[model samples]
Target chain A: MNFIELTDQPIDVAKVLQSVSHPDAGGEVLFLGTTRQFTAYPDSKEQDRSGDAGGQHTAFLVYEAYREMALKQMERLAEQACQNWPLKSVALVHRLGKVMPQEASVAVAVSSPHREEAFQAAKWLIDSIKADVTIWKQENSPSEDAQWVHPTNSGAAHE
Target chain B: MIQIRLFAGATQLAGQSTVELSPTDLPTNPTVGDVANCLTARYPQLQSLAAKSRWAIGSEFVELDCPVESEHSLAMIPPVSGG
Candidate 1:
């Protein structure tokens, strides 16, 4: 059973793991991506060290996505990974809306005939999710200021 | 009319979830890039995000030169931050 879901509710890892459990699979890999307390943006202006460094204390994250697109992308990733690997089952879940720090935002679980394939598929799924998924997060400060997180260029700050 | 959905920073920059471009407002046949340009023209603040965003028709991503029609589902996909 391949599980693909996008929810505003907290992710149920037990169910995710259970979905990937198969008789033929000897190994299963589950990866949980949790929201961090602090978010440090990758500086594009690394050459100039005097600019505003982007290590901020993110109180929480507000996640939003193109819902239809996101689900389609998740389903596609699960299908592609299953075809690429000798896997038994897979589950991919991503959280939407407000997510607190230290909470699990994303989960990827895959079962395979061997540990190598499981690990590889799990990694690829997570990586692809980060790259192609339409989801975006807003970093909210302790004082409640919100800043949309995006890959920045030069030294300009996001509005 | 073709309503292009915007996400993430593009949404924030545009101050709206979607940008509406009427058929009469555009040329005879518009490409994905033309619609993108119309977006920036409509919302100047979205220049940076619009430039970086990828235009998608339905679930598949399309390049700038790809021809777009009003009936097709369109979306502006910003660089994703999801894990």
Candidate 2:
């Protein structure tokens, strides 16, 4: 069963893993992209704005998407993965809005007849999602300061 | 009028998620670049972000030179930072 979704609900990793399970498949790969804390670097606009700059932990994240477009892009990438590999099923999902640290913000799951293709497709899907998907995230610091992660600017350095 | 959807940093800078601008201010048969130009002219704050943004139509991204109609759904895609 191929399952795809964008939700504000918490991700169930087990459910994602189960979505791709099939009797014919010998391997199933699931990757969860979880949120993690980051330190605010010096001279960042985020730093200057918050005045709580150097080395503060991020408390949470707020994610956004051009919803319809994000879903379309996810579907396109999932279909592309299937075309490039031999897979039985696929599950791609992302969380939107406020997500606490250590939460799974994104999940990619795939099943294939063999181990090799399953691993390959799972990696490709996650990488492509990072590159092409319309999803975006903001870092909410412990001080409640929020800064959008712009891949081209300061956050790009930390990333 | 062409409607533009903005997100993340672009939305933050524009102070709104979406905006509609009359195409009358643009040249005849305006292209994606023209739309972008008109937007930046109206919201100069978007200029910096626009340097790295991508103009998209439907599910596919379009070049700045591509022609667009008022009815088309257009979006400005900023440098994405998703997991």
Top DockQ prediction, candidate number: 2
lDDT of 1 by residue, A1-159 (tens): 699999999999999999999999999999999987866654636644344455678899999988888899899889999899988999999999999998999999999989999999999999888877888888899999898777654112221
Number of backbone-clashing residue pairs for each candidate, in the order shown: 0, 0
Cα displacement (Å) at residue B2, model 1: 1.1
TM-score between candidate 1 chain A and the true chain A:
0.88
Global lDDT for candidate 1?
0.84
What DockQ class does candidate 1 belong to?
Answer: medium
DockQ of model 2 vs. true complex: 0.61
Q: Residues B1-83, candidate 2, lDDT per residue (tens digit)?
A: 78889999899999999989787888999999999999999999999888778878885788899999989888998878788
Error of 2 at A149 (Å): 1.0
DockQ of each: 0.56, 0.61
